[model samples]
Target: MGNNRQTLLLSDSGYDCENKTGEQMLEEAKKNLQSMAFFGLTEYQNYTQKLFLKIFSKNFKLAEEFAQSNRTFAETFINKQNDTVQIPYLEEIKRLNKLDIELYSFAKELFFKRLKDFRIV
Candidate 1:
């Protein structure tokens, strides 16, 4: 006896099959992947913000501003760069508030290290 198998292709809605073509299925897969990636990034960002606040519990506003600025800088500059470079706003924040420079440096290093390790930088 010969083994026979059948594969079923379901539409994105998963209720029925409309006889979609290969290209259509590929496009649907790409859309789903992009959506999943976006969702994961969003969750990661939220977690990072919470972690930052927890680390700098005494200066929530400063931590929030710095996080926001860093996000903007990364999106606008670091993401486009091929070479590793310094983050711009940390020094300004340190000078403005007489913050613990070493602590700030350590936190920044950890953040970038995590990004690099994840290959997101």
Candidate 2:
């Protein structure tokens, strides 16, 4: 099952699969996984404050609970964003925002999917 899925992704992503050894294939797969994970992290870092604000506007208590339980630094980070002229973590955010459309899309989908877990549905 895993090999079938990997084959599909490799073809879809334009990998040249004809002569690659199994170790080579495995290394490529690992790299892809790491890249996707990095995208997801960058997406969360870039947009978590927006998510917090949206939750705050709708359900203040829930938002507070979420921050306290899941993101203890959220309030401080938001305050820094508001009080300073420069955005916090701008470089990290731009890492996703400026490159790799496929990775950006993957990160975006992962970010929005958290809305369900956060009970925003």
Listed per model in order, the count of residue pairs whose N, CA or C atoms clash below 3 Å is 0, 0
Q: Which stretches of candidate 2 lie over 4 Å from their true place?
A: 1-47, 50-99
TM-score of each: 0.23, 0.25
Q: Cα RMSD for candidate 1?
A: 20.6
Give the lowest summed-lDDT range of ten residues in model 1.
1-10
Q: Which candidate has the top score in TM-score?
A: 2
Could you give candidate 1's per-residue lDDT for residues 20-70 as a string of tens digits?
543454345344443431222232565455454554556556524423322
Clashing pairs in 1: none
Best by lDDT: 2
Residue 80 lDDT in candidate 1: 71
